[model samples]
Target chain A: MNEGTTVLITGATGFIGGRLVEMLAGRARVRALVSAYTRTSRIARYPVEMVRGDIRDEAAVAQAARGVDVIFHCAYGSRGTPEEKRAITVGGTKNVIAAARASGARLVHLSTQMVYGTPEKGVITEELPRQEGGGTYAESKVEAENLVEAAAAAGLPATILQPTAVYGPWAPVWTVGVLARMREGKVPLVNGGEGACNAVYIDDVIQAMLLAARREGALGERFLVSAREPVSWRDFYGSYEEMLGFPATVPVRVEEAVEPQRRGRRWALPQLLELAREEPSVRSRLGNTFEGQLARRLAGPLFRRRSTPSRTPELDKLRRLRSKPELPVYRLSPTDASFYASTARVEIGKAQRLLGYEPGYDLRAGMELTGEWARWARLVPAKAEEQQAQQKRKGVEAQ
Target chain B: MMVGAGRAAESLHLPAAAMTAQVTTSVIADRNLERAREVARNYGVEQAVAGAEEGKAFADAAILALPHHLHARVARELLEAGLHVLVEKPLALTAAECAELGTIASERRLVLEVGMVRRRFPALRFVKRALERELLGGIRRVTLEEGMPFAWEVTSDFTFRRETGGGVLADSGIHVLDLLAWWFGELEPVAYSDDDMGGVEAEVQFTLRLPSGAPVEVELSRTRELRNSIIIEGERGSLEAGLAFGGALRLDIGEAPLLIGQAQPHASEAGGDYQNVRELFIEQLENFRDSIRGTSSPLVDASEAMVAVGLLERLRAMREPLELPWVTANTTRAA
Candidate 1:
């Protein structure tokens, strides 16, 4: 099915996008859309038509979408302002969808599990309602996916593959960030780090993206892509040390210093911005940013350093609900406590049943491959050439 | 002085230098010799040096990987030494400095190129060609919006500090702005607003007017999420370019969007469709080389760099500050 198919892969220099280019190199005719800052290292190895233009540009996307059979829309930005994110995520998707529609090509979009907003309780599925509040990054993804859904409703051929915490080669944020923190003895456990984390290896996610491209059933459908086993945050780091054969490094509990105090004085805030401003106009004192801050702060605990109780009624109540703990790393600040506290396992049943997607690598094998690639990419240390050689001889960790 | 040994140098500059026909990395410089030496070894450069002077002594031109604030001072010193210079984008923290550097490069007769590498991409170049070809008729309006989650695993402190020319506008905004200038002359700002919250702006929106009264809108950020692309609305039709994967340029004339052209990874002079993004960097380098050799001007010269930086400063001046409970979500990687 892959033979003689023309494909377009956007964000080709990014971690997942880079891998997609490598995997699809010999399989099909590929066209790549990358950014100005994109380095050549990830993409130069493959033979793909590399285009440079912003996705917000309708003309540029239309130009790239010409003559392609299917497009692997694997590119989306996670960090920017609300309007900027809306323009790119929601607006950019519209452009790609239009391009795909114009050319009569199918789209395999790479999305994230954050659309469901890291369910704090149980396994999240494709059927769950998207969060009304998933922070800026997650919120924007929800908007982007909505655009894709609207396009599909209009008869645009497209499939959405939402992956969980993906870690692997050149994963500048997840894999490398974690190892760097761990090796430097900056491992901190927020709320004891016991929350579930669903991680899918990079290659596995790449496999799912490719599968969704060819599978007819995948079109007009949304699939949750994750691994079979979901591990806790502690086990996640523990496995890293074990795979490297490094002695166990204890995780520091940093609950008190980071988590917000929840028992202080209370007030009602149904609409945060409304309370912030006396006027009803958009340009009033309470803007989107102001309202957002007011609402989020009122709804969540107030993060602060632990200190002696003032002995007042409200202060005592707050003190009773809060306690202080050590801060291991400045990098692992209060937000991380919330992140680690809120993580929930995601379900990949849809990907499994529809796309026949199954993870080929367990945590052990995935980390091994990731380690090998990380070492080659110079993102992690290779203690010895012998240790590097030992990876090939090693097998999957005992389940 | 190439003050840092981070991604831009490792993944981009050196590799592209290797691909340049006559260009070869002569010096690898960084505060960290370990990284510098390793980088030198990877690219087969002859010398690996540390600190400011030791590094600048070996190369005829230095790619300033230093923090943004340091670009002006270091480039001036190198220029006095009769050396050419290529500074990373956002030429300097402000517009005046960029203009001054452009003046110095001109007086020195040395090639000074800002690595706004997008102009070197054949696909983007194709968009410029199509626009010039009037495929999209008369330009009416243009919108350039690009945003990504700021998840770059950078260990450099300079990237975070606003005084040192860090932040979303300086880092990500300049690239998109440079491209905007290239396609639609210097975009004049009509109004500007941003959500900076006393830190670097995570998001910015610009109401701009293109050359000949084509209204343009520009959105840039480091806080929220989106796809990076530009949409140009012209008289006859429209154009869309995806800035995510190298770049993909498309055109539509009344009917469904037609994929009229794609990026030719190399400029033919970039030595035969070199397989990697090195081709774009290599093409940029070749432009620098040709400019120095008195063969051609830099593809994105210092003056062009000044235009983007200058406009950026004006926008920053006009941006209304925002107030939000800032989350100390790790702004950078903790290596």
Candidate 2:
């Protein structure tokens, strides 16, 4: 990638691809292939050529890849059903591979470390075989990697980069998502969050992608890109707690599914009340009706019975319902428990040696920067008192 | 007459106009004649045309729901043709353009209202009355946050482009800024920052000084779900109101929080009950009709709406890139 090199980036509206466009817009002639559904506010600021198209459109992908020297195939379906994910991850990769092959453009595919799945205990590296049944997202990535590898064997210039838990500003999963859960006090820690986290800063991953795009030796190679050392899951989320100025997450144990015991007829009204509380749409719909309004107006006085010496079970249920509903606790699923309990440490020595890639931001530095964004994004408050003091100082200076 | 049959005209203005007995929507116009015809058929309008010029003969008042960039030119045309115009929010892209429209409307003595429908919200009216009555004594600080995932059914890509007056600040910030100006008389821009590199911003944070020198912090976004509420802290107490058109207004003084106002049903002129957002739009339409009929003044006339436009213009002039510390020095140096 040089000053005059023309590159087409798929998923240019996404986090990684958007950042890539920002970094490359000034140095290279950047072209972005964006989907109509995705908002382009993040990347439309740059002087990059935007081509509206989805990766599944072969003609559109080829059109965007035309006259370009490099193709950054970063688009993947993160949402939707399994079939939709497969269509985008596997089928879309097929189209990208075809386009890359036809245009003779160097392809750099973004894969995930989840291809290795929840390995029991080992130093995970690029040489390890990708597991088969690692759920929809991981399986899709594995299948996509297979396509890229097949294309590489057929003499198409391609490089695969598997990043582990990429987290930084604008990161949906590890940064914003974690902060939201932590703020709600719903962050569930499986077995006290003792799992090893191969957390990598987003900029470092972009650096690896750039190196892979430019380095001749990176072709026909797959690299596991991550920070130098792994951090514990507790430490990973703990950094966010420190930024938030309070501890909010709770620890929960992993257990098998349990069936609810049947209750007598007295529990029916309480169950209905719980359901109404859980679903606002249903509650609102019922509340808007004439009967519901009349019932609501009368139910309060009807259920206001004082505790008597011979209280009935129905009265006790009504009294309990009158009290505040308990907040539901977050519990990790079996798969999530297994994922958060993994002890495997991902190694990035291959990327370091082969592509001259070095992690620019360590865990502490990355979290510090992330904290700045979190405050700026208002994910965590920049404390009202502090902001007022700063404003007052600025106001005085202006005066 | 309705110019530009886009999402707002289809869902909001048309439905509200149908409910207002004094207002009759006679014509629907758009550059794309098919869209105009479809909307006209759905709304049961008498005629569809390719441009406002063709539709002007059928109606006395026109609702200009065109894109933001076209508001000034189209409204000027309609006002010059001796028609009352109700343009959508922000009036125009710049404060000067908004002022120019106001000048034309005043010169012709036509009703030129801006569709800042949030001004008609019951909760907002309650908050304004509370402030006027000094219920929350001596306002100290104010913070307003409004955000939601970008899910609007836009007819074109203009909403995401800067040249078309797109961005969260222009689209959503206009409503909030107008509310602030309505509450606390003139706003002076303090500082402005946004997550924009060279394109439109999805998220922005800025500060303004009210007439009393109190700092007003605003954060608007089209990318995430925020608290979506406005909090005004005062020396005596505080008030929190929903940023949405149908949000509740709450007063918090130290004891249990009291809900001052929720979605209360109000009787319309036609003797029908309307509530929440539906009532908001209906009130705005009725106000526009009454302004045209010389029975009442516009809630948000062109000149009054320009206050927000001026503040936005100044904020954009002093805009700084929001600090993105996660961007490595290497990337910055490369750029």
Candidate 3:
């Protein structure tokens, strides 16, 4: 974007939208349409004009969209019921589209590759037929894309970007969530993690977004944005495992993992303890009780039942000593297994050809960045200790 | 008079003032007169005013519960009007501003207590006494991790703005820093970093050296749930305490963890028994009132609260972009 360009970003508090605001803050007159419910700490550091309102509010959308050269419609509901998701994804896009059309501004819509649903074994492209029944998130995203396509067809200058498995710093799913699961040693691998992962770094998706907004040819088009090569799930998760200085994750069969979930016995004692440990409200309530105190005392020995030693000889003893006692194994559901087992590689050649978008970060580079953030964020204890040592050295030097 | 009918005022200050026998609910002032009226109606406050200037005339002392940036200016105005002031924490955005307000209050002989209600927590007070008595022996290192999802009902987006003194370090971390200063002696900055890429930081990690040369490692966040506890390792034993007002202190000296001071109903100085945070707020309000009357000194005066603000200022000045290798890698490649 040029210096004089004015842009309004919806979902400016979210991972992608927050990063966009960071990137575009000084380059353009950035205006963020934030919801009151979402914390504005992420975007409040910048000089962006923040307008608090939900995307469902049409008047708020129109007001925020006024005098903007472009509108980046990145806001979509990821939680709540199907109706709520549709209201935000489908309904919110309708409001954004109307605002963009009224203001004669280009619209850059962020869609997901999940819109393709569980595809058959083949390369997936933008021309592939959109599927439904994937889940609420995927279904709603498909509906949102349809609206964007309709708007583009109606002569509104708009482009839709379908990014595959966007992962990097601040990414809730592919980066942070994956690291959390791996750290917990609960990530289940379906078919030994052989499925194709069309993982793209967040920066690459953002680069595609910037290109889509600027290139005239990008209008009236849906671009599939991803890294140049698809990595195996083993490699994708293994990369994070390596970053955390941990051994490989043990793989389990899909059926073996899904059996307990199918029987509705997911909330076992061990899982409940894990949940109580993670949730503040649960911990506060349960921890105050005498039984909770007893359980807290016994939890170490109970969960730390000796298991088969790790296959990795060098790090097995260190891992055993340092890691929390092995909690119950977390298994992937049938849907997650299907998605992880898919071999369809997403094609981003159209984005490269049309918008001149090139994937800047490979999987290794992306994970490296994510690992750096995890360490800085204190998600990685090993790195934190190392950082502490470095800081102590710096202290000595200062003295 | 409560000068800001915002969340802290509505939830804590006004409710605590109603329970404070020495104080009366006089006036509620806010930029939004409707909000002031609503809060005043709920608390049985006598009047509602548009701003602090109008509300200052209604009461002998004023509780400045306004936004962070407005604290210095508004408190200065109230102090100049010969009103005792109990402003919220981080009395001003900078140590200089805090010192200026402290000077104003000192010259006028008005009570200028900062609303650092955590200092009034019985558990923390117990820890302070334990430290003073050398119960944990000589301190070696202290690690504090306090974080939860940002759920405080903020009336506006001021908490996220840098100019408005928003950020995890300045907002919540101030309390942690103050506790360190209160328990330990002076602090020397070692290293500081945060995840601020131009916006207010949701996460921050910093190290400070106590006068005893022991390190204090602090990790604060507004995005995720952390351990939310402070652990002090000393020569003889370690002390672990929860960050919350109701959080208990646990002595880890024995074979098993020993609970020391849990948040039981405790007797206030005013001959009443209350529980947890509400009790602490009441005690703080009482302290403010008594300080104004010269019966007792403020528990946390402006000069004492300035220690945290000064540390904050120094830390911010010394902050390095918490090294995100990936961001650097990408930027270098692009260059």
Candidate 4:
């Protein structure tokens, strides 16, 4: 496609989509298709031609898609009201693909790295299976991506760009909001976050999107676009500490973290018992019958004749533990904890090597820029609230 | 040079209402001509107001922005001259001196206002409103911590010398002491200790009883890092406002949203100490203007200002550098 080729983009008012419009505006005849709700004066100030319409509106999509050779479908929802996420990330994608097909335009569908389910190794490539039993947002993205893959297989000229945690100008998530909270001592790292999260600056993602558009080989394939390295949660937060000229309070450990959970469980037990007693069966003899029914059904299956014939003692012990209330079980592995516990880091080497990606901003520089904004806003202290509060707390604690 | 003045004039532009007719002007009366002229130029008053004969004609009101010892003499002169007076506080070095001004103001029926600009902060107003509404029900105790870093670090002529009423208690703690008196009424005498470090009183910790016998503690320090915070602990919640580095007031009421009082921005980032202190000075000026017009009494009047002066004099006498300190009772009751 030529630089002046008419390119219609859905989700153009969103974080990634907004940046994509700005990046692609000078290079092409950009027509942004934004939902009526997300439209603003900020979008109007930009050079791109903004068409007031939702992606779910077929007629609106068709009108936007008319005469456009390339459709950059860069919209998705992460943090929004539930109704918004449903209308945008799920129904929005369906509308975009339909529009693209109607105009016979090539589609570059922007997906997320989140669809790749929790992995044992923190290294997630395009080949990883989708996470099972993810809630509405994740499940919807998985279904949407599956549709895109099917469309590509059916010979539609389509490409998928799954970028990891994107940061820079116009980033909605993991932007200055999270940084501001962290600077104010509001966000504390909980659960030992061993999971690696990959970040790509907006400039790099734009470059990746352009490269995907020009290359014929990228069609009918998926690419992971992110910063070359994954930052661990400790080092991720240390960037803020470096900016503020303060030493990091030692990383909170898992056992210490679990202490709060244990306390919460103890506090909740009384409330749970009150709930149990208020039930109709609990106040009658039916409570005994309920316990008897539970034991008859559960005990016989565990004490099966074949249980003694189990080959592995570990499996036998596992079965015993399943029946026992006192035995403890660890449902999450360290690697899984890393993915769900702290922050997840992605490895974007494939995108870097294959897609020719290079990020413009580093984590330290980004954090310094973010800190400058925070200081100007007076969202956090300029110099000494922390130090003063520390001394006061120490004095009070000593007393 | 002219352009800089033009810009400064534009930057200093107050609303039309802020500029009232100069009904009562100051005979600023400083031997230091440069400082006096600077104050005059900033406030847009004439320079002859400082001279003795022309002083009374200009002195509808006298502003004693002089050292603590000089306040009583200046006040007595102005009061005798039949000019309403506003003085920078510790209204005088002694209770006797404070009472002299108080008696004169009472006799003349002229307003004698003391400049305590902390009360002008929006956060403090928010706190006072909350207290009135009983949001934090029946405020029982207050903890005040005040300091001026200059007292500890600098050996300057004004602050380091004790004869000028240069102790940390007089310079900074007086503000907190007066605020405590205003915040929790009917201050009953109680136990206190003074930690005198070197040339002046380095720190003083006082325990007082409210009229209702609620215990209030105040710790005044010149030794450590600078901070000014008053935590008003009420029956239901508490409010904390302080002179943060940026001169901010941070308010907290249990799990409720924290309302902060910050210096109104002049331009850009509202840079550094001069701007913050200058704004506070302007607030006091406005309040003084209001008091003269009978719109409202200036927040810190002579009576309240004298309480701080009285407390400081008693404190200076008691500063024996105690070895061990402890309070007998730490309890709060309904007011």
Candidate 5:
């Protein structure tokens, strides 16, 4: 399918799908199927047709899928309750695939490496069996991919692209979130930041997804599209501090990373105990108010106005050992810490040889490009290119 | 164009060259020749040298993104070779070292900028301009606080060394300290104590007297998160300069009680990147480039960073050291 073909992008207002619409606008007849929740869309600027519909709604997916030669299914829930996740992932995929089948359109399904269940093996290839337990996001994605594989086996022209930790200009968790946190002088590095962050640049993933549409060898195949080399979360993410223009500090060992089991007991047990100690409704309200006032009175000393030498004598200061008046450091949910620890590197030779995919952007280049967009958007403050141009002009004057 | 092709140079500072007009990396030198070559390749730099000596002719000026202890040594070499230089913070470990470097820059007529990134924040810049504009009265009480848990991935070992001016104080504290000096002129350290933990302090608390007799209380940490803000009480009223970088200079101004202060969050906006460090860093570079072009002196000079280092040196000297449990984990990445 080329310029004459009709293409429908399910999550056209999203980061990846929006980018795809931009790339494919002139190449084909592009129609964007954006959900009502698409707050802001760059695709709205393009000449493509807009179809407002939730992917989970069968009639909406079917109506939008009508007359399209290629359906690039990319929408999924990033946030919601558990039932909503399943509806967006498994239920939504089922509706999209059925529409694609009904329309005889080629389905280019966007899946995630999360299906592999945070591999224990260092280098995962596509041949490995799909592990079952990676929470709702992974499990739901796996269920969707399973439906895709089944549809392909039943003779629907379909392809699946499993993109790894996709990060770019607008990728919330990776680029924006990371840069945002770096500004605050904190990045929660799990397991001393030694875990693999199999980060793939968005451009690379886009290229692979595009190639999946046209490549003859991609029929009925699942491809893992990622950077050739996996970066250690430290070397990969630790560099964010230096890149974002802060002096690098020794990463503090997160208790959640090093001692996750005990952290649960330390955190949840007290809350559970407090909840278990039931009182009459009126007494509970009064006790809560009293407790809050008492705690405030106790913490009053910490906020006291001080303009003198520390009262504690030198060497006898053990009494105030852990007493500090500052902000609480970066705290991650135990689940998040575990996710950081379990991130795995994988081989992408299948994408290279089969789909003719080349992982063009390394971690540095990817981050640099993201920084460029961030600079354009005024997220990051430093500008090296401007400085370079000034230097060139100065050299011309000197010569 | 840059020395020390380590993590900082590779990430924030290196990319910053691309963002600024007159600044770009022509060559990068690192201890590891391959690493230098790799950085040069990644950033599209033309030449990758093995050491500082080999990169002398590549660019008009150089940014010293090296570690804290190595600033003066590397800066001196670059300065003597007739290269304009920008040194990263804790400009040098000592005032005398910074002075020596400053003398050379003066003799050579080369611009020597210091990498005090936070000063470039819109909020802090606004705060300084407000003080200079005399819209606010004489300083009364200053509270400089930043608390966030220690959660960065540290790769290099030298950052943990005491001689190198390592730990949270030098790494994160210097920015707040330099900002304090920038706003209030100078600070006389009345009291300083830190959770030394043997190698370096993870947390520090200080009582400083500003020139206007304002007691500037500072708290910095890599252990806990604190309200990352600056509160100033003047003769007329008080203003809180909150959200230092990549966000608004959230200010609240009122008479006696700040609780009754007017919340002027969107009072001033439109920084390069109000919420990102890169924009402030770019602003700093832009100022440095302008200084190089004879527009004006940089917003922060070598002296500003030197004052911060001097304070750090004094704090370290007066420190009541406490030992933290010595434990090391082999956290090398699995193959």
Candidate 6:
């Protein structure tokens, strides 16, 4: 794509979509289609044009698509029950496609790897069929991907990019859930658990999309963008612990089917299915089949069955990512603490080879050195005390 | 006798016939029983309530508004007499004296209250509520500057003397220190040092350690020309409140620097000091009444006030200017 080609973007005010606008601003003529609800700040500095309208509105989407060469349709969620997800992700996609077709624009749809559900063994690829999954978030994304496939069949040039676990500076999930919790010493690891997850930094995900956008061969195809190396949940936690100069405590485990667990089952597929069933409108769409069928079909029969000790061997084979642990030291003792450089390992090779991508910033260095905050205000004694507590726990566990 | 009675009736601001109807009265009770009747008549109370013997039978509730030195003895007597009591600030001359009074009130099941008027101050209450909501986001540091002129210290007796809870600390310092302890619970004295005006602390500066390791600095003096203010610096914002000038409070809720230079006006028509103090005293009285009725507990109960007294005692002792060990609640070994 050249500078003259206008790329129309929906959900441009969102975390991922905002970054995409910045990434494509200097490269292409960017037209950001932001919904009225998500429009927060007035765009002043970016080399982009803004169009404020709801994606659910067909005329508004058509207006946003005028004279655009590429449509990056990322809008989802209408703030309602299970039925809303179908309307927004499925119905919204159809409307977006019609607008894109009217303007003769190629589409790049943001898809998730969660559609594959929990993978059985080796890395799941783009060619793998969508398996049963949990919640409205997954079901809707799968449905949206189908709409894009249908659009491609109807001669609207479209491509799908499925990125797993995007994390960086303004990353919404990892920052709040993992990093913040790690800092506060409240992280929990499940079972004796090792669940391997592949994550790419947000910068790489944006790069991958840019590469796919320009490549003529990417049309009508789906691609998986990740860091290539997989990190187990156990070792991912360990890296955060290493950064804090402490060994984090293993969280206490309770029966998964206990009442306490049942009461607070946020994001559980069964609960979402129950909620979906109570609403008559949603049940009608699913043909009034008995409650739990939608959850069973989406989450698969294998997931519905109890996970047993038979899967333990397969889980154990996954390697925990190695991180440089805190060097044990007292004030008088000589220590190797100075020798350690804090870093998170990422596999940049796949991105480099496939997309001809080069990461502009040293992500680790950028993390260590940022805007103006006095580090001296956070005294070493306070940090050391926290580290000592973590080390003591680890010692007990080892014994 | 009839002429004298008529003159008294005219002076009382009531018709002669309805004089026995609800009497609009004011009362003043010091230790001297001889002056009680005279003071009560002058102030329009139908009868004088005394801290000493014999005068207790005539009053509903005795206002033991005596000097700091007389508070414990007089308050205990009033409580023993089965009448509720309102004592002056510092509650008593010593922390031990305060405890003794508290015990007497408990034994008699009578209402006893201290007059710490600043709790009812609009600015202070606003600051307190903001802290509770964490709107200021974990108070990283706090500073309190409170002082008054020597002219305002009209009494030369117990108020100016160190032995009678009359020093700058016991008199004026309690207000700011209590404010600090209430704003951030469980503060340990990190550092404290002060100057003496002929054996009384005329000036004091101290640093306190909050549970979060944040610093709370207090600067109090008796020589400065009447100033009372508190400034708090939070993670994302700052709050400033002043009591000496117009009783006006302003809060800036954003990252806009220290803003230390903002000056507030000293307006004379703002309000009267006694009116404010009287209202707070009424509030304290009602709270005590409610506690006795089992409807509500006293706001600044004995336990809470005892902690403040402990902090004040430590601050006063720290005035001698010595390198003190960090004496926290858990660190009795260090002590």
Share of true Cα-Cα contacts across chains kept by each model: 0.00, 0.39, 0.33, 0.00, 0.00, 0.00
The window of 10 residues in a row where model 6 chain A has the poorest summed lDDT is A330-339
Off by over 4 Å in 6: A37-39, A42-45, A179-185, A191-193, A239-399, B1-335
lDDT of 1 by residue, B1-335 (tens): 34467778888787777767988778888878999888888878777888657767777877877788888888888887878887778678777888888898888788888888766655666667777788888777677778765666554545544566666677877887787777777678788876543334556777778667777777775633454678877777788877753466677878765764445542453233645666767777788888888888877777778888888888877876542211111111100
DockQ of candidate 5? 0.01
Writing each residue's lDDT as its tens digit, candidate 3 over B187-269 gives 89999999786768887999999887888999898876788888888777889877886677788774656767664433242
| Lowest summed lDDT window (length 10), candidate 2 chain B | B263-272
lDDT of 2 by residue, B59-171 (tens): 88999988788889999988999999999987998889988889999998999999887776666766787788898888778888898878877666677777778788888
Total backbone collisions for each predicted model:
57, 2, 3, 8, 55, 2
Q: After superposition, how far is residue B41 of candidate 3 from its true place, in Å?
A: 2.9
Candidate 6 versus the native: TM-score? 0.41
Cα lDDT of model 6 by residue, B3-55, tens digit: 01112222321231123232233344444445555545554556444434556
Q: Which 10-residue window in model 1 chain A sums to the lowest lDDT?
A: A281-290
lDDT tens digits by residue: candidate 2, A5-97 = 999999888888977987887678999998873477667666667788878888998998998899998899887999998999999999999
A1-399 per-residue lDDT for model 1 (tens digits): 354888888877778887776667656777787665324333543455667778899899999989999888877765587788777777788789999999999998888887876556766889899885766677777887888888898898899989888997667677877766555543544555677768888778887887888787888999888778787877777766654455323333443323223312332343332433432221111212223345445753431221222335574344223311121232244445556776566778788888988777677777777666555334455657656665543222100
- Cα lDDT tens digits, model 5, B17-105, are 88899677789998888988888889999998987778988878888877788888988998899988888887788888988888999
Residue B71 CA error for candidate 3 (Å)?
Answer: 1.1
Model 5 sits at a Cα RMSD from the real structure of: 22.8
Candidate 6 residues A1-399, lDDT tens each? Answer: 667889998878665786676556556788877654213221212445667677878998999899998898777764688897678887788889999899998888888776765444455666678865446777888988988988888787888878777665344565334555544433434332244546665666676777767676777777776765656655555544545555542422222211222344563657644643454322222221222244446766654353233334442332111211121111100111110111222334544555565543232422232100101112112245556986785455323
The positional error of residue B2 in candidate 5, measured at the CA in angstroms, is 64
Query: What local lDDT does model 1 show for residue A30?
Result: 78
lDDT of 6 at A17: 81
Alpha-carbon error at A80 in model 4, in Å? 6.2
Backbone clash pairs for candidate 4 read A195-A338, A196-A344, A196-A345, A197-A344, A197-A345, A197-A346, A198-A345, A198-A346
Per-residue alpha-carbon lDDT of model 3 for A61-152, expressed as tens digits? 99999999999999999779889988998899999999998898899999999888867469999888899788888898898998889889
Distance (Å) between predicted and true CA of A232, model 1? 1.9
Candidate 4 chain A weakest ten by summed lDDT: A280-289
Highest lDDT: give the candidate number.
3
What TM-scores result for chain A when each predicted structure is judged separately against the true chain A? 0.76, 0.80, 0.82, 0.69, 0.78, 0.64
